[model samples]
Target: MPSRLRARDRVQGPCLGAPAYGSAVTTPRLVVEEELLRRNIDRVAVGARVAGVALRPHVKTHKCLEIARLQVAAGATGVTVATVGEAEVFVHAGFDDVLVAYPLWLDDDRATRLARLAGRARNAIGVDCTESAARARAMLPDVELMVEIDSGHHRTGCAPGDVGEVAAAGGVRGAFTFPGHSYSPDGGSGAAADEARALAEAGKALVAAGVEAPVLSGGSTPSLAHTDTGVVTELRPGVYVLGDAQQWELGSCSPDDIALTCHATVVSLAGGRVVVDAGSKVLGADRAAYSTGFGRLLDHPDARIVMLSEHHAVIEMAERPPLGTTLRLVPNHVCNAVNLADELWVGDQRWSVAARGRNG
Candidate 1:
C-alpha cells in the first residue's frame, strides 16, 4: 500500500495552507488548491518531458483560464479542448495553440466561430468521419486536422486501418487516438500498448498513401505511466492535474496528488447515515463500476456515500460527523464535478467559470 499522509500534513502544504483554512470564509464552495494543482501539473509535465513526449494538457478537466495558464507556464506544449466554445475561450485568453480533441460537425455558426479561433492561434480539429472533415474543410480550408483513431475507446474515431482513408478524405495534418480504454483497470497498460501499435500501423498506412503523418497522439490518465511514445509524438492527459476517485482506483495517482476538493457541510444525521449538502448537483452522480461511491470523503475514508439525490448526499458513517461541520470530498470524476460549479476557489484566489454553461 502507498504511504498515506495525515490530513493535517496534507492541508499544510503550499496549495492549502493552514491559514487559508482558518479564515472565516464561506463554506460549501468548490476549491482547487493552487499549490496542489501546480504540483500535479508539474508532475505530469516532468513525466512527459522525461518520456520525450510533447505535453498537450487537456483543458476540459478544469475549464478555468488560470489553470490553463498555469499548465502552459509549467511547460505544456499546448491545450486540448473538447468543444469549440472551450477552444475559443482558451484562444481568447492568449492560448496560442489549441486542439479541439473531439470530432466536430460544424454548423454555419460553429464554422464561423471555429474559423475565428483558428485565426487566433495554432488550431487543430479531430476528424473521425469524412462528413466532419468536409464540414471543417469547407469552413477553414487551411486548418490542420488530426484523424481520430478508435484505439479501443469505441467512443469516437475511425478504426486504425481506416485512418488512411479518413486522412485522405479530410486532407488532415496527422493522426491521433484517445485510447480511452486505458481507464479500464483490467486492461489499462495492455490497452495503451495495443493503441500504440495501432497508431504506428495507422501512421504507416497514411505514409503509404503519400500523406505525411506528423503528429501521432494518444493519451489518458490511466495510460500515462505505460505510454509508449515510439509511435506517438504528443500526449493529452487532463485529469492528472486533479487526481480523482477514478484515477485513484486505477492506480494512476496517489491520494495526496488530488488538487481539487468539494467542501460540503454536513446537514443532517439520522438512521446511521449523515447527509451533506453536495449531491449529484455538486459531486456529480458518476459512479463507475469500480468506484466505491459518488465521491470519497478525504478525512473519513470509512464513511460511504450511500445515496445521492439532486441536492443531498447520504453518507454512512460509523460515527456521525457533527452537523455544520465542513467535510472535504474528492469527486469520482473531476471533469463533471467541475462542470457543476460556477466558479472555483484556489487558495485565497478565485476564478469564475466564464465558459461554464456552454454545452456547445
Candidate 2:
C-alpha cells in the first residue's frame, strides 16, 4: 500500500480549521478542502481494496484532472466517465483505462472519437440493446462493450435477464448498472440489494448466451456502503468524493465529511431574512423530493435555503448575520453545482474543471 493513501482503519488527524474567509475572498466560488477531499477519496479506494474489488471511480463528480490523478495514484484500476469527450480529456491526460458509462448512440463523429480514444487507452462503452451493441462493435471494434442492466434505475438500461442478446451482439466484455434510486430518503439498502441481484442475473444470462461475463459493476454513492462486493467485481461510485447536502441529509456521510462548499456572502437582511449571492446559477437548482431545501449552510446547520433566484438564495434562520458575513453553502447535488463552475479552489490554488460541459 502507498504511504499517502491511508487504510480505513488508520487513525485520522484532527480536523483542520476552516478556510480563510475574509475580504480578499470572492463569493459564489466552489471551494474544496484538500485534506477532506483526499480523505474521502482514500476512504472509497481503501474500501474497494479491502473488499478485493476493483475501484474505477466515476469522474463525473469533480471532472478535474488533478482529482482523477489522485484517484489513480491511490490505486484505482481506472476512471469512469459519462461521455466520449470526457474520456478524451482523461485519456489525453495519460489515463489508460476509461469507461464511458452511458449507453451511447454512436454516430460517425462519435465512433471516430471513440476509436481514437480506444487506440490510446483500454476503453469501453455501455450498451443496453443489441442495436447499439452491434453498432458500437462495428464502429469501434477496438473498444470493449459492457451491457447496461436496468437494475431498477429504469432510466437508460435494459432489464437484467434481457442482457443475453446485448452481450452476445459483439465485443461484450462484461455487465454494469447504476443503482440511482439509492438517492431516495430510504432507498439505499434496497437499491444495493436490487443492484446485486440484477448484476448477478445479468452475469448468468450472459453465460447462458455463451458470452463470458467477467466484470460485474454496480455502485452509487448513497448505496455503496450497503453494496454486495461479493457480486460486484467492480465498483463505480462518483459522489462519494464530494459530500453534498443530499448525502448529509440521507446519513450517507456526516456533516464534517463534506469537503466541498459554495462560498457565499450574506448580501441582504430584508424583513428579518438573509439572502446570499449564491443561487441557481452557482449552487445549482437540484432540490430532490427528499431534500430538506435547496441547500444548507455548512456552518449554520439550522439555516435553510428556502428559495433561490438566478442570482440569489433566500435563507431562513433564527439569527441573521451581518451583511458582509460569509457562509459555506453545501449544494443539494454537488455534480451539477460543479458543472456550473469553470474551476474549483483548493486552499489558495485553483484547479480547472477540465471535463466540464462535455455533455455529449
Candidate 3:
C-alpha cells in the first residue's frame, strides 16, 4: 500500500447529519442517527424494565464500544456476543459481563482463547449438545455455560426436553434460545410464544437433572415485543438498536424507528432505474424471502432495489435524478451491514467498528 493510500484519504468530506457541513460526504458510508439510536435503545430498555426482564442486549448489531456502553448505561445487565473474539473485545473495553450466545465447539486454541476471555470477564458460551458441552468444559473448565435449546428456530440448539444432561453437566448455568422464525410476516407472536415454552421446558429439565437454571434468555427484535414476561429472565435482542428494512416490513418497527442507513451516491439515472454506489458489499445482500429488496431507499421509500451487485444497487424509481444525487439506504439486515463497515458515522463524529470481522 502507498503512503498516500491512508484511511483518512479513503474518507470523503463532512457527514450529512452534521449541521452546517458540506454536501460532498463519502458514499457507501454507514451512517447512524444519534437521536434515533438513543430512542431505539430506550424503547427496548424500557419495555424490558416494564416486563420485569433483564436486558442483556446482543452487541453484534453495531460492534461499536460506544454503542455497547450506551446500552449498558440504559440498563443492560451484560451483552450477548456471537463469538469469543467479540467477548474479548467488549471485555477489554470494560464490559465485564459477556455471553457468547452461539453454541461453541472448542478445540485447544479456541478453548484457551475463551478461557482467557472468561478470566477477564464474567464469560459464558452457549452449548447445544453433549459433545459441545464436553469440549467447552475441557477448554474452559471454570467458566459458566448456557444450554441452547431449539425454540422453534430449528437452528443449532437441541430439543428442550432432551437438554437435561447438557444442562446438568459441569460449567452449565442456564438455557437460552433465539426466536429466529419471527422474521416471517405476522410470526413474531407465535415465535415468541415458542421461545417462552422452550425455555420453560428447558428450565424444568435442568431442575429434574439437579441443576439450577438461573438465567433463561430469549430474544430477536421481531419477537421482542411479544416475548412473554415470566418465562424468560433476560432478553437479548440485537437489531432493535439499528432498525432495518426487514423489521420495518414485519411491522416490528416503524420508519421513524430506523436509526441506521448506508449513505450512497446516485451514479446513474438510466431509464426508470436509479443506480447507487452502495451495494451488497456495504449494504449486505440479505434479501429475506419476506423482505422487499436488499435495502430500502430512505429518500424514496416506494423505490425497490431490483438488483444488487458487489458494488452497485439498481433501484427502481420512476423519477430519476441527476448523476450526483445522494441517498440513504436502510439495510435489510443491519447486523451484516454494520459488520461489513470499518466505522460508523454519527453526524460529524465517527465510531470504530471494534468487533468487526470477529466472525470466528
Tens-digit lDDT string for candidate 2 (1-360) = 655444522332211124544324557799999998999999999999999999999999999999999999998999999999999999999999999999999999999888777668999899899999988888776668888998887898999898888877767878999999998988899999999999999889888887764689999999999999889999999988989999999989888899999888778887678898999999889988999999998887888999999889999887677776677899999999999999999976999999999988
| Candidate 1 local Cα displacement, residue 193, angstroms | 1.1
Candidate 3 residue spans exceeding 4 A from truth:
1-21
For each candidate, what TM-score against the reference? 0.91, 0.93, 0.93
Best by lDDT: 2
Over 4 Å off in model 2, which ranges?
Answer: 1-18
lDDT of 1 at 3: 38
- Candidate lDDT scores, in order, read 0.81, 0.88, 0.86
Ranking by lDDT: 2, 3, 1
Q: In terms of lDDT, which candidate is stronger, 1 or 2?
A: 2
Better of 2 and 3 by lDDT: 2
Model 3 Cα lDDT, one tens digit per residue, 255-320: 888899888877877665789898899988898999887778765778788899999999887667
**How badly does each model clash, as a count of residue pairs?**
0, 0, 0
Model 1 quality (TM-score): 0.91
